[model samples]
Target: MNMFLINFSMLWSFSFFFIFIYIITIFSIIIYIIPSLKNTINYTKFKKNSNFDYLTGFDLYFLLLTPLILFLILNFSWSSYTISAWFGNIIFSSFQYKIFFFIFFFYSLILTAYCSSFYFHSKEIYDYTITIFNFFFWILFLFSSNTLFTVTFFIEILSTLIFLMLATSTFSTTYFYNNLNLNLHNYFNPTTPFFFIQMLMYFFWISLISSLNLFFFLILFYLKFLTFDWFIFEFIFYFLTSTFTLKDIFFSLFIWFNLLFSIFLKCGLVPFYFWKPIFFKGIPLHALFFYICFFYFFIFLFFIYFLLIYMNEIFFFFLIINLSLLIIGIFILLFIICEAFYLKAFLAISSIINTLFVFLALNSTNFTDFIFF
Candidate 1:
């Protein structure tokens, strides 16, 4: 049985990592080598753009499909082997994992059908689809996370930063194609700075979480503490032991406040809401789509996690805060939505609604089961 238990998450993760390398190699052959191959072989009888166009975005659908299939594979219960060491009931093999993949699979299928839309775009725009697909590969691994929750959390933050960087690259690529420069002298926009700011937020979160993890881990280490035979996860299952001491409580509060503060910034809820409107302004619709789709994906998971963990709490502290966010965020957004004003403003409001809704869900649910509903 021990021999049978290879690290499947690591296996799938490294497999996708290699798949990306393989993909990049194939792209290299198509983009660079194929032209040389055609030129030497006197196959110029074909159209000049045919070789590049044929394969520019051909694999994007499969890239998406691969994860969907991996999800199915993990869930199939081969030899009745189950995923062990998951922090929760839901791991790669769980029914919830299947449901998650099914939803994303449908989304991927929809996006694949829309690849024809890319065909209508300029070669540059069409070619940049690779970045988007590559982005999904790392994100797929978030589901592949194993015993520790930190891996997924860190991967998520890294992926978020990469997505933003890719978005910026796409924007720069677009500008180059259309001969538009967005320098300070010509035009100042939100594209670069928004990603930069978010990256900073993610780094802050990572550093804080790592510090908290290390702090607790060292205490667990130095105290010569053996298993408490008990554990309670307040957030992300990081504490890893029974902790109810005053000092422990204070430390937990410190971690929680920092983590939640960073999240509030990302969600763009009230009082910390200054940056999101400016960030949304003048951004391309495609860029906006990337942000909405990916950011909310993480936010939704966090929402669900919090709902499960906090539902049975004796205190109503977080409940009040979440309710405050929902009310204040929604009422402010109502003014933005009703005004029928700038497109970016509407987009910001629409995007922020996901976060507000999460708050609303958190506020309304008094039980873990309600989270699923």
Candidate 2:
């Protein structure tokens, strides 16, 4: 018990320190990039009413996120090697710990770049690239982590907050540009070069907080100060994410149970449809459907949120049944929707396939139920 506690304590401390370094790195990039930006600022172009070159802000943030991301990846790589070398052939306890740092660092970078670039290049080409990258990076991140439930719960919260911010900000920006007649290109774009940087800061800060909270949660559980809520949360997520038939009996039962559990805890689930309509209205049509479907798809996430508050054995089985249904329904849904819409067809198809595969595996007896709770 002492040895386990000691290792747990060290992991918590190391995770905190790693996050600290990560924050410093982002701030350093902002500080470094600002000067070059000031030097490049051309008042004459603004004064003459020329369209602000989209590439400038894009290039600056790209350069900023790129090098630091590379550096972080390098650090994770080196740290992993150091652990292996020190431990020789033994399965060191720190093996998974070291991998989490790498996974976190890489996923953060991919998300930052995806966010930064998506703003400037509204072209279908770049948008899809970034989405694909983010999706794959998220997969790798979840796959590599040592503690699935802790990481996933953190990710779900982070994603929810980010989507809400996006929905709000996009609404505000669109309103300002269309109604107020503010030039989104000249007046707003150049002045707000730090937009992506601010988001990066916010995301990093939240991740740090979540990491700390995870440590405390684990420690308390270890000391028998709290019960492990992992099974409940994880089970719900696995069911909701993996299930296929959306409007079916099994699906409705899951949602009903989730709502019941949420009410019990006094934490209500957001009416997901309300959030997505505004979010989709702000983006291009192709992107609109994409965002809407993605948001709609996660309505199942309510199960996870509710599970965090209350755990019942029946909740776990309900999750599995719904997930099995969801898997089959999503693939057929995709085939129909993609054929009808014909927009961002590749991503549309990919989303369905990916969703189906995740669900199919979830229902299969061989699948791991580790990511929930």
TM-score of each: 0.60, 0.40
lDDT (Cα, 0-100) at 307 in candidate 2: 37
Candidate 1, position 75, lDDT: 52
> Highest lDDT among the candidates is held by which one?
1
Query: Can you give the lDDT of residue 332 in candidate 1?
Result: 70
Cα TM-score of candidate 1? 0.60
Q: Judged by lDDT against the true structure, how good is candidate 1? A: 0.48
Q: Superposing every Cα of model 2 onto the true structure, what RMSD results?
A: 12.6
Q: Which stretches of candidate 2 lie over 4 Å from their true place?
A: 1-58, 69-73, 76-149, 168-282, 285-354, 361-373
Q: What is the lDDT of residue 316 in candidate 2?
A: 43
